[model samples]
Each structure stands twice: as C-alpha cells, then as structure tokens.
Target: MAALSISLSAQNVTGLQGEAKNNLLRLTWVDSVDARGPVYIYRSVSPFEPGTDLSILGRLIKVPYGVQSYIDEVEFPGTWYYFVAASDTEGQRFELPLPPDNSIGIEILESSDRLAVSPAAPPAEIAHGGEPGVNSLSAAVEGDSVIVTFRAEDRGRAVVLYRSARPLKQARDLVGAVIVQPDIASPFIDYPVPGIPYYYAVIFEDDLTRGTAALYPGRNATVEAVEVPQGSDGVGLSSSASIRSLPLPMISLAAAVPGMNAFDETPSPVELSPEASKALEDLEPVQRKSSLAKSPRAFSQDLEAPGGGEEYALYSIMQDFFLKKDWDGCRNALAGYLGLPRSSASEARARFYLGQCYYFLGQPRESLFEFLSAQPAYPDESAEWIQASLAALVK
Candidate 1:
C-alpha cells in the first residue's frame, strides 16, 4: 500500500462573547496534505482513550477537497471526540494527524448568550438615555423629601448616583434606591435622614466597547440635607434645572461670565504684571510659552497654531513633562520638539531648550551636544547669549 500524507490545525476563538453571553466557535488551521471531500466531523459521548472504539454521533460530509474548515452546530455543550480522515476514489483512507487513539471527545465548551439589554430597559416610566442631562437634587425646606431631576437625552448604559461628603472626594454609590430613568419631570424626590451635608453626582455610563469611558459627563452639584422646619405647611418650590457645562474650563468668551457668559459665570482672566512677563521671558521661548498661564485648557490650546485648531504633538508631550515634573519626560519632549518641522529660528529655540533639559538632567556633555546644535542655527546675538551661558557653566 502507498502512504497518504496528512495534517491538522486549530485556532483560538474571538468576538464570541458579548455583554454576558458567548456565541459560535471559530477555528483555523494550516499545512494539510491532499485533503479531499468535506472534512468529516463527529462527537463522542465520552472522552475516548488512545486506540479505543468511540461512537460517531455525527459527520460533516462532502467537505470540499483542501478545505480547512468545519463548523458543527449539531453538538451540544459537553466533551466530544473529533477525527478527520480522507478516502480516495479507490477507498484508500488517510487520517490527519491520526486521532489520539479513541481520545476524549472534542471539548465543546459553550457559554450562554447575554440577553439584549434594551438601551431602553428601565421603561419610559424610568427610562434615561443619550448622555445624562442636567442633574439636580435639592431638599424641600418644608418636608423631608429631596428633589432629584435630570435629563437623559442620548441613549446610554446604566445611570448611577454617587454621594460624597467632601467636594469631589471618593463617593458612595446611591443609584437605584432614589429613582431610575423613564421618569416624568426632570427632578424626582428622595427622603433622607436630616443633618448631613451631601454632594451628589449623576453618572451616565457610556455604551462602552472598551474599558475607557468618562463615568460622569455633566457637572456635579452639592447640597446639605437639613431637618424639615417644624411648622412650615406648603411644599417648597424646586429650583429650575440648568444644563451642566463642561467640567474643564475653556478660554472661550462663553466661559467668562456667570449668567452672562454663554457657558456659565466662572471667572475672568487675571492680567500678568510687566515684571511677571519679563520673568517669564528669561526662560527659553518654548518654556515661556508652555508655562501654565490662564486655564489649563486654554494653555493647551495656545501650544498649536493660532486659535488652536489642531494640537501640536510636541506641546502635548511638553505638557506631560510640566505636569509630571519628570526630568526624563522633559528630555524626551525636548527631543520631540527638535524633530518637529519649524523655521530655523524656532529650531534654535527648541535646541536651546534641549540643552536646558540635559543640564537639568545633570549631563553637561549631552547639554554641550544640544548647545552646539543650537549655535549655528541661531543668529550671532542669540548665539552670544548661549556663549555667555557656557562661561557660567564652567564657573
């Protein structure tokens, strides 16, 4: 009899799980020899030992020759044995990698599929969706009940409530007990024991594919809980809910005034003094420009082209160095600045900072490398300033 060559293959399954469910089994293979017909598939009732007779529960017949796939949905969740063999026109048989003599059945490890969560579940009666809108919870002066109002304009995942004693401290979860979405008015009422100052935040969980997401999108409000006054009869009117603005402050005109400012009245810019300006100018140009000036967001905006449309990549790196106070980060950002496309003048300024970063790192030789790179790139007047610095370094 002539020999028939054979091979077998397998692969890990992916995208087979969602929410809390799993679906479909996927496999891959390579390097097979003269495969013909649909690869036959079978499930064994029990684990088959090597060289043991096993029951053939089913077969995936007529598998096209050289085909590397066989998806069997007939099998249920349990261990099952599988074997593939090729039969020639003359009835000659060749088994791929020969099954472990009657080995344990192929493990059909299955998991349940997660039921579809209605992006609209909690009912229109309590439905909340899109991003969380205004979140306001205030206690009525006459009664013990507190009012909680919010708008869920966009459909999202679950909405949760957290309460903190201190502003922005770690919060304790207070989500379901108060109220859920699909509610009538924007604010609902919750009765709490009196005499504790409470800070509340409503978190709208994003429809997250990955782990990264902003837990809470809108502004958080704080209110202290107080005992209902002894004799008041009428229910206190709740304050009108306002749209919560972005948590991070921006330099746009809308952010300047409170009621007048388009965003909300926060504050105005404090003018820098002449002396402060000159002190800032003493640093390299990039340093002077990169330092925190007004709001962090505004400062970040100024790093790129005027009016801050696209962010300069180098500025982002530099900001990390400034915030982290990491010398190594400064060095990395300095190198990145050098690699940026810029006019020769800008290059000279960037090189000067490269030297400064090295000096900060206590590497005078490496600092000299950057200073040398800057000398020819800068004008004589600028180069002279660097020359004077060399004398200071020696001294």
Candidate 2:
C-alpha cells in the first residue's frame, strides 16, 4: 500500500455563490478536480477577517467530498458573509483571499413567521461556466422591460444583473444597485419602475466563483436605473398584472437603492482622523467601542404594538444616545443592539443612526460598514448617508 500525497499549495473553489429565498440560504461552488477531500464553509456578520481561524465564526459546516451545494436553515434575517475552501484528506485547510474568491455575501429579509425556516431543497443548481469575461454590454428599452444585452466571453454561465440610477464604477458598486436577477440567462429583461432612466451591469457566476469577476464599470461591471415607458410590460398582462406576476422587483427607483450609494459594501481603507491618529498612538486592535450604557432606553410608541419588543427597546437606547449627539453612547448601545437573536423593523434605523454617529465623529470608514449593513432592512432610507460617508472617506 502506498500513501496519498496531496500538494499544499494555493487552491480555491471557483464560482462560490449564495442566495436567500424565504429563510433558506443556499450555497454552491465549483469543486476543482485537484481537491483531496471534504470542504469547509464559514459564515460571519462582517466580511471574514484575514488569517482568522474558521472555528471562531461559531458556525462551520463540513460537507463531504463530491457535494457541490448545501442549504442552511438560517435563524435570523440580516446580512451574512460566506466562504468555502477545499480541505485535504487529513483535514488540513489553507487560507484563501476573501470575497470575489471563494467568498460571497447576501442580506436576508424577515419571512413570514408561519413559513417554517426549514431548509428547502437545494436551489435549481448553480449553472456555472463560461469565460466570465464580458464585452459590449449595453441597455435598451424593450416595450415595458429593459433588455440588457452583452456578449459573454463564453455562454451558459448564470449572470447577476444590477439596475442603478447612476453609472456603477465597479463590482463593489453592486451594493448600491438592485439585483434585478441573481441567477438568470443573458439578455436580461427587467421590469423596472416605469418612466426613469437606469444603468445596468452584468456579472457572471464563474467570475464570482474565481474572485476574478471584479467590476470594471464599462469594461466589465456596473449598470442600473432601467427606465421604461409607463404601460404594459409582459405578454397579455395589464400594467398591474405585469408588476405582480414577475418575481423581479418593480420598486420605485428610490426604493430599489436609496439616493446613490447607500449600500456600497466594500470601501477603501479608511485613513485615521488626526485626533483618532493621536488617540490610537499605541492602542491595540482588539475591538472598537464608544462607551457602556447604564440601561436600555425607554420604548416610545405603544408597547403592545407590533414593532415594540426587546429589539425596539434596545434600539430606543441607541436612539436616545443619537439624539443627544452622544456618538460614543450610541456606539456602545449598538454593541448590545446587534446581539439580539432576530432582526426588527428598526434594524435599518439602528444601523443608520450608528452610521451617522460614526460619520459625525470622524469615522467614515465605520460609517460605511454600518450603512451597508443597514441596506437589507431599509433600502431606500440609507443611501444619502452612504453617499455622505463614502464622500468623507474618499477625501
């Protein structure tokens, strides 16, 4: 008998993807033939920090070799980041670069309480392939829908189309655009809010899997705001029927994605403010906080109301701090607010305020993170803040 020798070089799962349907989170990836055995999956609230052990995420799943997809029954509805890596026969795993490679993130919305959170069967299957490289991407008005046509480097790969009010600069701009179709065939036809112009961008499943699908605006990524004439869109369907029959969004331009960049998920590294630079002269990077609060702020509105609960109570405390312009107090309260087991209607408000606190206190970088996190809950309300925070950080 001979021993199996596996090379421990840099390897990654190409085409990693995640989609949220109701309460189900489906993840799928390409299994490179070079893999030795099992695969490891990890999830986190924020982007996965480099070099951190997978176990620390507190939710690690190991799928046996040959399994290309897994469905997770998620408990809460909020933002979730995920990454997958192939493991060796003995379970040795190598660290791969985050997002755009073996990593993808999606924000889940609260589903009906009666609708069980049990994982549904794996999604139709991640149709992945094609060169992923794209060219001649353009948008044209088609009756009631906008037809986004582009030449894919190769065909058969699933594409994610985005609609934005402004031109997208890169794939990162995706956070600011509405995902018209997460997994669809090319020549994407979208039923957007009638009467407004939009830009569109197309990204491939293969690019997402290989982390090479980074957006290049006109060259590769960025497009949105598909304005169509106000009238009938689908075949033999009235305007109202067209809006209701399609699974794609028919939301107002402002609702689809706030002002301009409310959901800019990944911003460049933030430079320390002069005062912050001095304050961090020797401080170690453990975790940043403002200060501790004595108690949860009293709830406003009726306690028996649908929106009133522990989540609301905690949010109130943060609001009180925000009202007094107490950035640190608000930040400290946010520490507890985010720990709640489930998300609430106030989820967007809480994050929006925290984003403001960071922005007013000269922490635009942190502000961007909070605003982006808040998008799933309150898509239309936070873009202005995202724009301001981004402008500040960029300067």
Candidate 3:
C-alpha cells in the first residue's frame, strides 16, 4: 500500500511569531492519520516561497498523533515568513494549508553581537600639503620590478596602502603594504612586478579617541592611476607618461561597532619548545583557511573505536575546527562520524557535533535534520543541547 502524507490545518501555520522577538518560531499542525513520518517545518525570509530559492531555513519532524507543536529557535531577529509541511517514509509530501495570502507573522527582536564585517576598498585623495585636488599616481613596470607611486594627504597618521594583483573585491589576495606615516608628503612606492596589472588604494589614519590606546583611520578612498610606464628604469623623476589626478569616492559607516580582540593575542606565560612555537606560528593565519578548505580531509583523518576510545580525538579535532570558525568542516566531520557504523554513544557524539556545525553554518534546516536524527541516540540530559540546537534552527 502507498503511504499517506500528513496534511495540516491553516490555523496550525497561522498565529506564529509576527515580529522579531529573539524567540523560537512556534508551529502547530494536525496529522491526518497516525503515521510515523518526518514532518518538516519550512521557513522563508519571504512568504510562500519554494524550499530551494528562499532558504529552506528550518526543518523538523512532527511526532505521530502527538501535540504537533514545534518551536524553531534558530531564527534571527528580523521580519521572517514561514510555511509547514509533512512527508511520509515513502517520500510523499503533504503541505499544510498556508496562512491567508501565504504570509507568516513576525515579532521583531534584537540579535546578539557578532564578528565585524571585513574592510572594503580605499579611494584616491590629495597628498598632505598638495593642492586641493586629488594626487597624480601611476604604475611603472620594468622586468620583474614594478614601482607604484601615488600622492595623497598626510592625514595626521601613517598612510596605509594596499595592493592587489587582481581586482579590489578579492580580499584574500590583498596584501598590506608599508604605512606612510602622517606629516609626511612623500610619494608612496611598492613593488608588484612587471607585466601583471594591479590596483592600489591609500588610507589615512588618526588616533582612535573613543577607545583607550587605539588608532583608527579617519577616511579611506581610492584614486585612479594616472600613469602606467612600461620598462621604466629606477632613480630620477622618470616622467614619461602624462597623468591626471582623480579623487576616489568616500564610503560611509552607519555606526561605530566594537572591534573584536583576537584570542591569539592572549599571551601565554608558559614557555614553548622550538617545535611547538614553529607549529603554532604555522597554524596561526592559515588555520582558519585550511580548516575551511580541508574539512573533508580532517574528517577522514579522525579515528573511531568500538567504544568511546576515539571520542577524545574526535572532540579535539572538532574543537580545533570550531575555534577557527570552520563550521562547515565541523559539520562534515560530524556527518562522516555519523555515517560510520558505530555504537550509539559515538553516533550521539557525532550527531551533537553535527548540530553545532549546522548552527554555525547558518543552515538551520539541515542542522535540524542532523539533530532529530541523533536525538534518539543520546540520553535525555545530553539531548537537551541537541534539542536546543534543533529549536534554534526552526525559529
């Protein structure tokens, strides 16, 4: 016999959170029949949108013939809309009637603080003591040696410069050049190499008066390079190409947000072996990037045992990845652990990690999938965190 998918009521989907409340999204539904199935509660930033286009956002399994209310705790504080549906083991889907006109309610609330957004590209400006117009800058390339110079104001601090072989958007490729200090109206020079085109920008910095013992750049802008001299030699004002000065547009920030202090700066009083120091140095910046890139490899490298013998190793690796903000890697490693044919304890641990990974990756829907799958494998006490992560995903 073909299985019957659970159809739900309109009231089950209506009367939900209508504002951003920093609370879980409450969902209720009535199963048509007593069927053991995976009931999914889907949410969207927009109303009545399909699962894929709009983020699936959240997912949950409705218990058979029980009080079918699920609290999704993963929603951010914003105007959010949602929909609900259920599916049977046969993969047959039955969608609940959507709210009137297909829009879920929202109660707006506040979200917690997070990491700062990365810095953007800089613009062009006049050098200190120069005329009111923008400075004239150019790129001179000569056989593996490229000299880039620009005239900009000495804005009371060192002139911070950035050079990129590619366009300005690829921040990973942007390397920090020397900072030309304030009160200096000198031409800035950087070597980028010949034949390779490049983009450049300079920023002027000022002491951060708001924070104690801190310095901040007052303004940043980009300028057009006026000259690109091919095979230009060193020494003397080699003025071959005529250049023009153009002021880079200024960007604005809405508000001053608190900056994050890096954990690596937490000085450890203990001495370190030469090998440990080298290893730590190697893992510093590259740790985060490598974790993101090699999540699968890290996952495969973890060892598991017949009992909980391998739990420590797994936890250690996951902890390392989590600290590095390699959430996807954590999720993949957990998923790999879950796929292994192992005891229930190991599976529970894996599932817990899976939930954490999903939460950090901003995929509450998939995170929900992992949480519910692992819920039964864990004890009641341990499952609390599992449920918490699940609840977070649905909201």
Candidate 4:
C-alpha cells in the first residue's frame, strides 16, 4: 500500500484562566499548542455587541508567537470581559471560547467605590472687616520661574514672599516680598535658578482698613501678625531676610516704602526678567481687524506693524520642529506656547498644529479632541481638516 498522509488544522488556545486581585487582572493560558503565529487579546466592559468585529473590541495586547499570558491594571472599578484569538502563519485565526475553568471575567472594587456618601461640610464664616481674604493659593515651578496665583474673596492689596528653605512658620523666614494689586490678572512670577526650589507665602491687606492676614502653603492665618509701626505714616512696606550661603538670588524691592503700613497707594509695576518678559509678550492677546483685507495691498499695509519678539521666537521654533518631523518636540513646544494666554488666532493655530503632532504620534483620540477645540476658533480654515480626520477615525 502507498504511504498515508495526514495534516492537522491550527489548534485553538486552551487552558485559559484569569484571577482578580484588587485592581489587577492576571491571565494565563497553556502553551502546549503547536501554533506558530501571533495571539491577540481583546477586552471590553460588556460583552461584544452582536455582529461586532473582533478587531474593534479594543485590542488589549498581542502576545509574542509563543507567549501565553497577560496582566491588565484597571484604572477604575468595574466588571470586565476578555477574549483571546490565535492566528496561524497563513492568516487563519481560531478564537478560543469561554473556558470551563472560570477564567473569562474579572471584577475590580476600588476603595472609593466601597465608601459611603458623607454629608457636605458647612460653609465657612466670613472674616472681619467684610474681607473674604484670599483662598486656594497655589505655587508651581514652571521652567525657571515660580508662578503663584490665588483667588481673592474681596478687593485688596496682596504681597507674595519667597524663601529658599521650607518650615516657613514665621514672617522672618521670608527672604523677599513683592506687592501685587488684586485688581490685575497677572500672576506673580519669581525667577529662580534652574535646579533650585523655593517656598512662598502671601499676605493680603484690606484697601479700606489695613487689617492684614497671611496665607501659607496649606492653611490660612486666623490671627493677623502684621502691625503698623509706631510714629510712621501709613505707607506700603517691603520686608526682607538674609541668606548668605544659599545659591539663590535676592530680588530688590526698592520702590516699597520702609516702615510704612497701608494699602492706599497703587502697587508699583513688577519688573520682569528677560525670560519672563518674553513669556508675557507671547501671552499678549492680539486684536483682530474688524473686516478682512480686500486686496494684497491691504494685507501688505496691515503687515507694516511691528511683531513681538517672543511671538516670532515661538513661530520659528514651531516651524523648525515641524520641518524636521520631530513630533514629540513639536508637541512639547506647542504645549508651552499654549500655556501662555494667547489671542484667538494664535490659539487656533497652535491647537491645529498640536492636533497634527498627536496624529503623527499614533494618538487619534487626543488628536480628535484638539481638532474639535481648534474648530471653534477658526471655523473657515479648520472645518475641512476636522471633517476629514473625524471621518477617517469613525471608519
């Protein structure tokens, strides 16, 4: 008799199992199969919709040719379902059905989900002198500057103090103080060295009565500590402390009157460093023309006005990054540019470029959001691009 021949089809994955611990779901499967192709894993919060393509279930992973395990760290509390499919070298895929070993689902219960709802806290009592004072004071290090911002409950004169070291329990620890009128929208920008960190405190005085209160990192002062010095008229005062050995630099408060105690006078303009000045320039809102220019001559006439230095720098950096196809660098630069307050046209342009960068980085969701934000600012220019991107993503 002639020799008999037999062949076997690619086997479906077997012995699949899963266990849930806290917010982690661990899955494992037997590797005894002789299949030689990639194994794809899919997950969903609910069972796949009827007639749903397996590719659209949101691929959780693609295990190597021989690997047979996966772990998912869920970010929220919920029940989740999972499935696995094995593909042969010839592009044939065999999906494994739910295992009899209870390995198809995982339930995560976060601590927050288990807690009972508590009653809301009572409203805070108003401060004396009709002064609501300042609250939600925050400080952050951005680049080489420390930006401080706070919400004022009442109109008042505010001062921000900076120190190199922490434990700023007393006013004497404050090395430099600057006056900031609460009427303005500008934030206090303290320029420090590149690598050093600093602490900050704020004091607000009522414009009518000089009742003073201080605000620290996490808490507000219940009692006023600043008192008007005897035998001196009510004038704005500058306070300072010394730090000889630290690498920090001292900011001058020469315009502040000494031994004065009053919030009557207008605060002196804050002198900004070169970098801060550039940043502020970049943030200045641009005024748009009431009507579009009709001809090339009109456009040329409009261009006669001088442009800001920082704005030019920002544009140059963006162009360079885009031309070089450096997606990450372009994204970061665009983000920094957007952080500064910008005009409507500038904001729209920056957002559009940022959306392009996100798309090139393989993040379609973020790109879609950015495109939507840019659409409102420049509808005529952004409508076509936004529609095309949305259509492609939907398909």
Candidate 5:
C-alpha cells in the first residue's frame, strides 16, 4: 500500500456578534482556539446564507486570527450584515457559519446607542485669555487733581478714558468729548478747576475695536462726579496722556467791580458793531466766504453786547462762530481779538469766549488759560468753564 498523509486545520470562527451605536458598528467574534493565521471579515446589505460565495466581494477587513472585535465607523444610517471566517496556518479560510456564530446583522441610525460598556471619551478643554473691561472705579480729590482709581484687566493693550459734565450713559456720550486718556492706568490724577462736577468712563481699547465692551455706570464709570476741593493746581491735569500734558485754566478775577457776578448777568443782544463788520471784512481772503461774510444781524448770538472798535467787532465775530458751534472759526476769530488792545470788560468777554472755543476744540490747556484770564468779568460763569476744562484734562 502507498503511504497516506492527513493534516488537521483550525476550527472556524464562532460567536460572531455585533452592536450598533452612534453610526458605529462594533463586530465581535470568538477567535478559533486552534487558529494561527488572519481571519477574513465580510459585510453586506444581506445576511450571509450558507453556500454564498465565500470568496466573492464583501470582505470588510482581514483581522489577525487572535483578534476578537473591531469598531466600524458608519457614514449613513441603514442595515448591514457581517461574517467572520477563521483561517489556519495554511492560509485557507474556514466556514462562515458553524453554529450560532461567524454571522450577524443589525440596523443603525444617525443617533447614538449604548451597550453594557462604552468607548473611551474625548479630550478635555483648556481656557485662554484674561477678563475684559474695567472695574472698581472710584475718584477722590487730591491736591489740585482728582485721583481716579480703578482695577482693570488688560492683556497688555490700551484703554480710552472719557470725562463728561453729565452722568455718562452710553458710548454716544463720547461725542464732542476729548479722550482724557488714550491709554490709561489706575489712580489717574486729573486737574479740574473747582466748580462743576464731572463723571468719568473707561473702556478697553481692544473691546472698542471688537465692539464688545459697554459703558456701565458705577461699574466701569463714575455714577457721580467727584467733588474737587476749592483749591486745585488750576494749571494742569494728569491721565495716560500725562497729568502735565493738560494745563487747567488759572483764574484771575482782575479789574472787576466787587461782587458783580457775570454768571448772573444776561446782557440784551445788540446790532453787530461797525468794528465787528469791518473786522469780518478784513478776514484773510481764504476765510469761509458766505458764512463769514454774513452781517451782524445775520449772525446774532445770546452773549452779544454794545461795544466799539475792532476788538468789539472781533468779539462779535467770535460770538457768531461760537453760536454756530464752529470752534475752528471761533478760534481763528480769537487770534485777531487777542491781538487787539485789551479792555477790562472787552478783554474779559474775549477771554471767556476764547476759552469756550478751545474747550470745544479739545484743547483743554488753552481753554483753561483763557477761562482763568476771564475770571474777573464772568466770575461764577468763568469758574464753571474752568472747572469743566480742568476735568477734561484729567487722565
């Protein structure tokens, strides 16, 4: 008899099972104990019946024979069937089904499902950046300046501070107001002439750019203006712009009759003085033609008074510009008025209006200077303007 040979192979895969969750299909199988090579995993829209071509398309993966489970990421919701066939060291595939094993099917949805055990979780999150805006804002009068104190959370960026005669309510209040400090820090010293009260507000420069910050009274802003002492430097103020950069008005109540408070005196309007008309005519050729050429009657204002000479006419011109809120034109008209002969009353009015022009123009230093010079004529009124100019200079 010729010699006969017989070789043994590994058992087929068993216990094939699947669990679907969150668009993921997890397949599990019992690795054949005798298996030595990789196993072939097949998937299809239909169940795997016996005699189905084991070599046909539908092979999902070839897992090592020792591995027992795999998680398949599903892109769409639907039904799927799976089969796991074990292999021997000879690389030959075993049967797809041998018992209640090696074959399974299930339906999946876009939503998630949980089993007795779950998958590993995702990574944790981390935070970045500091808090925005200002806080703890308060003010006190120190020397000739009001020391404004506050806590700010700035990430090495700039901030803007605003001063207002009225309580600050919105960003719109910033209109026509000088930026007391383009960049700011706490304990800012402000030079405010004693008289009018003032409110302050600070905003982060970054928030202003990002449009996220807001003005909140008593939080980042002063709910009330600080009561500055009767004595202040009356010379200059402080801010991120520097306390010294802004000079407050130095008041001089010179050449005034005793107790003749100008603040209470409301003079009646008069016709434009001939000197004022002549002065307007003398304006440089480049001055605004139609607006500047108007007659005194055409440019009447509340503060006009009867007077004579070039100074009086110049004063009239200043009044016209001032009433129009044309600070630039008013300031220009003042240069001519300042150059003329100084009259006790005429000079007082000029100084007062000049200060008004500078204050409106955002030049606190010059505004304060003129206000102080006019103190003698418009005692009470000049004091108020001076105090306001001083507050504007505050850091």
Candidate 6:
C-alpha cells in the first residue's frame, strides 16, 4: 500500500499598514493566499497578547474575499492596535501572522495637530443608502447646556449617542439620546452635569447600511452653570409663580400715551448720541434700564411704573418697540434683558416679549423654547404664550 500524504494550505493576510488622516484611519493589506474565506478585522487600544482569541478582539469589520482596505473613524485621539484574520471555506480560522507577529499600529493625534499639519479635512462621508450625509458636527457650551449642531447633505434622521469617557468601543457602550431630523440645521441641546465632560456620536441608518461619526470628544469642552448678574433692585423673584402673581401691569400703547393708540400710528426711532449709544452698548438691556431709573428724564411719567423704577423704564422701552411693531428691535432688547440676572417678574416679561418676537419671526420652535424657559420664572403669565407657541408648532 502506498503511503498517504496530506498537506494543509496556508491562509495568511499580509502587508498590513495604516495611514492617519484627521481622526480617520485608513488600513490596507494584501489578500490571503487562499482567497476562499472572509477576512475579519480587530482593533484594541493596547497591544494584543499571543494566542489572543480573534473572536474577542472587538471585531471592527468583516469583508469578503479580495477587499483589501477599510476606513475607521476613530472616536478618541490615541494609538490603536489592529490585526486581521482569515477563515478558510471549511471554517478553519488562522491569524495573519500566526503566533509570533505583532499587530499593526496607528497613532491618531489631537485634532489641533491635524489642523496644523494639513488644512482640516471635512468629515469623511459615510455612505448610507440615500440617507443624508452629515457634513459637519460641532458642539459649544452655552450656559448650562451643550449645543450640538449637525450639518447634513439632505434632510433625514439620525440617532445620537453619548458617553463620559474615551475610546468608544461599540454602539452599545453609549447612552442613546435624541433622534434628530433634517432642518435648516439640526441642533440638539445636551443638559449634562455641570463640570463633567461628555463625548457624542451620531449614527445614520438606512435599510442597507449604517454610518457613524463622532460628534464631540469633550476634550476641552465642559458645561458650566452661568452666574446671573445682580440687578439694581435688591429683591429677586424666586419662581415663575411669584412673577405671575406680582402686581406688575402690562404695558400697552393704549396705556403708554393718552389719546394715541400705538398700533394705530407708527413711532419714530429714538435718536441717540454717540456717547449714549456707547454707554448703552456696554450694559445689558436690564442693567441699562436700571441706569435709566436713576434719571426721570429717560422716560415719560404717563407710563405706569411696575416692580422697581428700573422695570418701569424697561416696560416703557418695550412698549415703544411693541407699539411700532419693530419685532427685530423688540427681540434684541428682550434678549439682552433676559440674559441679565433679574427678578422672576422681569424675566417673565422679557420671556413673553422674546416668545412673541420669535413667533412673529416664523420660528415656532424658538418661540416655544423661550416660552418654556419663562415658565419657571412666571408660570401663569407664560401659560398663554406657551399655548400660543404650541398651537403655532402644530400648524
């Protein structure tokens, strides 16, 4: 009888190398000699040990035979280790370099570094069958919230996920949040614990495939509670209820001037000297009103005084803007006033005007947000405005 001889075929992936462009890593390699099996890619932050189970190494991608490259959009800036393995048609798996070789490595630097070395590259376009492509992602700390903005190619849906730490391994590791849709621009407000950092990522999914991108890394960003400036009046209103119950009278053109209905007639823009303009510019509208309270010449006596002397002046200005139907001017002044530290009553009034301004501007969402923010300052007074905003939103 002739001796039977059998030989095992070699299935090895070779020539692995990576290049870092911005936060994205592009990996390339030569296909295995036995091109009959699928290739699996694995990644880790630390070096892989000998005999490490390819199954447990956090599989990043699986490609059919003949595909030689993959692009990974890394979430955090650091070094990453990667390796590839191939499985034969018979289901026999073999690591690329067998037992003694080290995994390929790539170092992702900070965004600033990438910006310095090259013109900052636009985010890599992730293809998701007819889904809108996100062009950019940015976050800014505003008062106590993180405002995240996403600019996309077309209007579509996206799911946001966030974590407090680095190296986001998988989608399951993140806490899912808002589902954003197409708008002029998509903005999501994340109310995180003050002083804690956060990292955000968004996933755009379609029927065929899903694309993921990092929104914010929270490296130098953090939420900080803003301190409201003290008002001229010593007393401050605590809650929205207190503001609504206050005896402050609403200013209307009918009450501001005798025999002259503001709505019936337009008021000329008030002329100001360069000195007065400069002075007013330096102070918030609320603070400016406080300054005016010291001078009786700033306002007419016919306007009823509400709350403190300062509020009387503010109401006078607000009434003038409203009577003239100058929505833009009214909105700007109201924004300045609301940004200052104020009694709840003052905040409530500012929010009301701001909400109305937004409504007139055809921005129902902003109108609703202002009305809701005012709720904590004056629940009763804001209820009507809130209802109006909600109605506009429904329309």
Best by lDDT: 5
lDDT of 2: 0.61
Per-prediction TM-score to the true structure, in the order listed: 0.20, 0.29, 0.24, 0.25, 0.28, 0.30
lDDT of 4 by residue, 336-371 (tens): 888888777667667777777876786654665566
Candidate ranking under lDDT, highest first, comes to: 5, 2, 6, 4, 3, 1
lDDT of 2 by residue, 239-345 (tens): 46655435775545335544545456534355689999888887777987854332222225312334667655754664477657787887878767766754565
lDDT at 273, model 4: 98
- What C-alpha lDDT, on a 0 to 100 scale, does residue 12 get in candidate 1? 14
Candidate 5 off by > 4 Å: 1-132, 236-395
RMSD of each: 26.0, 25.3, 25.7, 27.7, 30.6, 24.1
Which lDDT tens digits does candidate 6 get at residues 1-395? 12221112246676666777787777777766764688777876444545666564445577777888888886665456677777788766666333212246565655444511111111232111223255345566665455776655546553333334343333333322222321233577555544444554444433101212232222211121222233211124334323222357766765565666567754445579999989989986563332111111112332465776658657766677855667788788777766768777666666666777887787766766666666665566666655555445444
Model 5 per-residue lDDT tens digits across residues 146-170: 8888887653777677777777655
Error of 2 at 263 (Å): 55
Q: Candidate 3's residue-wise lDDT over 319-362, tens digit each? A: 66755668877666666666657667667657656666766666
Q: Residue 62, candidate 3: how far off, in angstroms?
A: 5.4
Please name the candidate that would achieve the greatest TM-score relative to the true structure. 6
Q: After superposition, how far is residue 217 of candidate 3 from its true place, in Å?
A: 27
- Count of clashes, each model: 29, 17, 33, 0, 9, 2
Of the two candidates 2 and 6, the one with more favorable TM-score, higher being better, is: 6
Better by lDDT, candidate 3 or 2: 2
Clash pairs for candidate 5: 144-232, 144-233, 235-248, 237-243, 238-243, 238-395, 239-395, 249-368, 276-313
Which sections of candidate 3 miss by over 4 Å?
1-22, 33-36, 50-65, 95-97, 101-103, 111-395
| Model 1 TM-score on a 0 to 1 scale | 0.20
Relative to the true structure, how large is the alpha-carbon lDDT of every model?
A: 0.40, 0.61, 0.43, 0.50, 0.63, 0.52
**Poorest stretch of ten by lDDT in candidate 1:** 11-20
